[model samples]
Target: MDMSSISRHEFRLEFLVTSLLFTAFCGYGLVWIEELVISEHWPLDEQRFWPGKSYDLNGYLDIIVAGKEHPQYGRPNILSLRYLDEVARINQYIVHNITVPVDLEGKHYEVAYTDLCMSFDWACYLNDHLTMLMPKSRWGNFSGPIAEFASDIINNEVNITYPIGWRGSEPIYFGALVGRPHLVDREGHFDHATALRLTYNVGNISYIWRKKLASWLTNKEKPPSGESQMLSETAAGEGQAHCCLV
Candidate 1:
């Protein structure tokens, strides 16, 4: 073989060995690196939390075991006018585009002005941000269902009864138990000011819930099972929602 060819062959062999050794060194380094752990004092004082950041949900585990008195994520209630504007202006199209998973316990209740107002608000907010990828909005174009549900609510065809007074006449509701998945943006980037705001954990839970609900709407699947307990006095308030996110 020519001297140049011989040199090229030798260089190729050396490069392969060096590459293999580098990868092996990296693998060893990873095993020895210390892992990150949350501070033990996290739950005692929520000051350790990051605003609009989704931390481990283990902090709120007590609610799962709290039993009846503990409360669901928040009480269901009327959708505010501000929220309605969000739907028309922002998240409406977005929510209709994706799917979300929620252990929806109660029947898909009819809409009162309160219900439409709240969910429409969320839909609008969802549409504004949450690109078609990642945390993409998933509320489907169920105007028909919504309209029908609204009519039903108007006519009192279905029971407007949610034993939980917190959940008065709102069309949409959601929560997380102890260690399930959550669906929140936690960035405080979304327009929850108009819609009902939630804490970090609550927002995290809502993010997942909304996503899943969006997916279900996209697929036209029936709502999932498992019931959600309640929490807090006011319900998905903006500041409160951001808090739970962390």
Candidate 2:
């Protein structure tokens, strides 16, 4: 008797259900797309690498060894210090009050040098940038911990020792290892100059972005078990410290 009424009620219920389902699917798709874009935006994989302009970290070990062996420039050492200044200049850029945003393992970090300096103490022109970030004081005032912390930075691991205020008489040291390395000639002579010329204002944004994307994708595809290993060397020069944004 009321067949027309029943049909109308069923059509309304069906349309409402369909609309709700469509809305839910659209919302989920938007979220999924956003995440995908983010993943592509900041990849944190270990397999990616972006060489720095002006001074690519070429021959870093040689530079450290040279800085240790030969205090004076133009002196013949195991490694050549001819191009060390260029690299030092680039490292200086890291602390030039510029900020960099980095994404590692799904964590967002804004890295900027809050404070830094260049010290030529201990008979070597060490980029003493990291010294400012060292913890003021610690339970033990030893050099071993300081050395280890520097190693972690060179190795590209986040192991900075940020203690409270300054520790009296407990100086922290970080050896320069993140810049271009010193090269040497076969005849035990410091080369007059380097083959590559450096220039500031390079295209670093796209370069860094590509690297971050690669790193992120690589990590998602294959997670890393431990800290990254970078080519490094030790020197007798005065140690320097570097700081990173939280």
Query: All candidates' TM-scores?
Result: 0.21, 0.20
How many collisions per candidate? 57, 22
> Candidate 1, residues 1-246: lDDT per residue as tens digits?
699988888789789999999999998777545222333423222323332122343221111111122255442211323323332322333223333433347645332211211222133122221121112123233466586665554445322112111212532222221122222344212211212222112233344443333243223233211221223323222332211110
In model 1, the worst 10-residue window by lDDT is: 60-69
Per-residue accuracy of model 2 over 1-246 as CA lDDT, tens digit each: 699988888789789999999999999999988767755754432223221211322211111212222345432321123323333444454334345587789999765432111111212223332233223232234467687775544444332222211223333221222223243534222223212222112222324422332242234233221221222322212121111100
Q: Residue 19 deviation, candidate 1, in Å? A: 2.6
Model 2: number of backbone collisions:
22
Runs of candidate 2 with Cα error greater than 4 angstroms are 1-7, 47-246
Off by over 4 Å in 1: 11-14, 20-47, 51-197, 200-246
